[model samples]
Target: MIREIQSQHILQALELGEIESGQGLNQEHGLGRPGDTRWGSHYKTVSNVTALYATIVKVLEKIGSNKIYKDDRVKAITVMSTFESFEFVFMIHLMSEIFGITDKLCQALQKGDQDIVNAMTYVKLTKEGLQQMRDHGWEDFLHLVVCFCVKHDVEVPTMDDMYVPRGRSRRFFAKVSNLHRFRVEMFISVIDLQLQELNSRFDEENTELLICVSCLNPINSFAAFDMQKLLRLAELYPKEFPTNDMTMTALRHELQFYINDVRQDARFGDLKGIHELSMMLVETNKHTTYNLVYLLIRLALILPVATASVERVFSSMTYVKNKLRNSMGDQLLNDNLVTFLERDLFSRVSDDDVLERFQSMKTRRMLL
Candidate 1:
C-alpha cells in the first residue's frame, strides 16, 4: 500500500485514485484509535464536486471559443469526461482554495483555450470517462439530497462575498455547501458542460463522428429532449396532436397537461425527476444543512461507503482524543480534524514519535 507518510503531491494524486483522507494537519496526537468523527462535514466532498459542476458551463463556453482545440474533438470530449472523477473535478477549482494556485486553475478551465483543452482531454471518453462521471454524479446528487438533513440548513449566497475566498478555502466550500435548487443542476451540469466542451473541441474533419454523435444522444436524453421533441412536433402539426403534453384522447382533455404544465397539472410533471428530488427534503423533513455538509450525510446513509472511511478516521483519531479529551478545546479539536481530514499532512511527524506514541497508548490502555 502507498503510505501517506511520503509526499503530498503523490498523495494528492492518490486522492484522485483511492487514497482515503483523514482529518488534515489540524489534529493533534494523530488519527485512528478512539473518537475521530464529529457531527460530520457541512459540505463533505461532494459539495465541492457539485459546485465545480455548477460553474462548468462557463468553462465550456470558454473551451468552445478557441478555434484550435475547437477542431480537436477528442481532446475536448476527453477533457469534458475526465472531470467525472471527484479528484479531477475538485482540482478544477482546487487552486481556488489556495491563494496563488486558485487564480491559475480556475483560469485554466475558464480560459477554454486549445492547450488547456488538450490537457483536459488527455483522458477521453473511455471506461474511465464513464466511471468518472458516475462517481461525480452520485456524490453530487446524494450530497444535495442530504443537504436538507444538516443541523442548520444554509441558503445559497446572494451577495457573493463567498466568491472571494480568504487564504483558507479559496471560496470553493461556500458554493458547494449551499443547498439551493435541489442540486439537480449538479448532475446535468457535469454531463452538459463536458458535452458542449467536447462538441466545440471536436474536429469535424477528423476523429470518429459516430462516437461523438452517440455521446450527444446521452446528453439529449439527460436534458429530456424526448419531451421537447413531442412539444415541437405538436406545435408544427396541432390537429394530429392529442394534447400539449403527452399524446391525448378526447376523454382526457388534459392529455399531456401533467407533462407540460407546472401548476395546474398534478405532480408538476414538467419538472419531472427534479421535482421529486426537491420534494425529498419535504418528505425527509431534513432541511438543515447544505453544500458539503449535505454530501456527508448522503455518504453516511450508505453503510459500505462510510465504513472504510470511518475506520480510517478512527485509526487517526485514536492518536489524538486519548486521555486529553478534557484538555482539548474547540481550536484543538478543529485543528486535529483538519489534519485527520487530510492524512498526507501527518507525514511531517517523526517516525519515532508515531511509534512511541502508539506504544505508550498500548501501555496506558493495557491493550496488546
Candidate 2:
C-alpha cells in the first residue's frame, strides 16, 4: 500500500514538474517494530508513523472496505476508527515530540567512546528541555496538534467543553475540561513520568559523583578542577579516604599543591582526558608526590569506565556463549570471551605464534 501511494505521488509530482526526472522519494516510510531495550527504536517507529499517517489511513480504509479475510477486515475497520480519533492523533504527536527530545541522549549513551562529561551535560539539557516543554509549550503544542488533526481530517475536541470518558458512565466520572484532560492529564503526566524515570536513574548522589568526576577532566588546562567537590568525592569512598580528619586535611593539602603544580607545568598544559593526565602524572613521578590526589584521579577514572566496560562484557558474552555452547566451562568461556572482546589486540597474533605457544605449553604426540 505504501509503495502504491509512493508510485502515485511520484507520478503526480513528475507530471507537475515539482521533482526532476531521475529524483525519487525516500523509501523508509514503512512502520518499524520497536525493541524493548532501546528507546531510540521507539523514536524511529513513532516518527515513521507520523510521517506516513495519510498513507496508513488510506491503506487501512481500503483494507476495511475490500473483500479480505474476515478477521483482518474487522481489525482494519476497528483500527481505522481508532486512528481517526482526536485522542489517538494527540497521543501520537505527544509521544513523537517526547521521543524526539530523548533520541540524541540515547544515541550518545550507545557510543563506545562516549565522553562521560558531555553525556552528563546532555542529560542536564534533556531534563531542562522536558521541563520547559511542560511549563510553556502546551499552547503551541496544542496548536500544532490541532493543525495536524485539521489536515488529516481527525476530530478536534473543543477545549472549553467538559470532557467525558469515552466508554464509561458519565455519572461515575468527575467533571473536567478538555484543556485539563490533555494539558494536565496526558501532556504533563507523560512528561512527569519521563522526568521521574530520568531522576531515578540519575539521582542526586550519582549526578553529583559524575559532576565531581568531571572536575578531574584535564581539558582546557584543568579548567574543571574543584577542590571542594573532589574532597566530597573522596569522602564518598570511605574505604579509600578512611573517614579521618587527618586523611581529609592531607587530601585537601595535596589537592592544593597538585592543582598548582599541574597548571603551571608545560608538560601538563596540553593534556586531553583524565586517562592521559593519569599516565602523564605517573610518567613524571608526580603520582608518588601527590599520592592522595592520584588516588582520587584513579577513582574518578575507574567508576564510569568500569561500568561501561562491564556492560560491554555482558553484551559480548551473548555472542561468545550461545545456546550451542551453553554448557562451556567457566575457564574456557572466559578465555573465549577475552579473545572475542579484545579482538583488536588478539588480531595481531599470528596462527603460527599461537601454535608455537600451544605446543610449548604441553607435550603432544601428534605434531602439526
TM-scores, one per candidate:
0.18, 0.82
User: What's the lDDT for candidate 1?
Assistant: 0.38
Q: Give the per-residue lDDT of model 1 (tens digit) for 51-88.
A: 33423433443455567655754565566555443334
TM-score, cand. 1 = 0.18
Query: Model 2, residue 243: displacement in angstroms?
Result: 4.9
Evaluate model 2: give its TM-score: 0.82
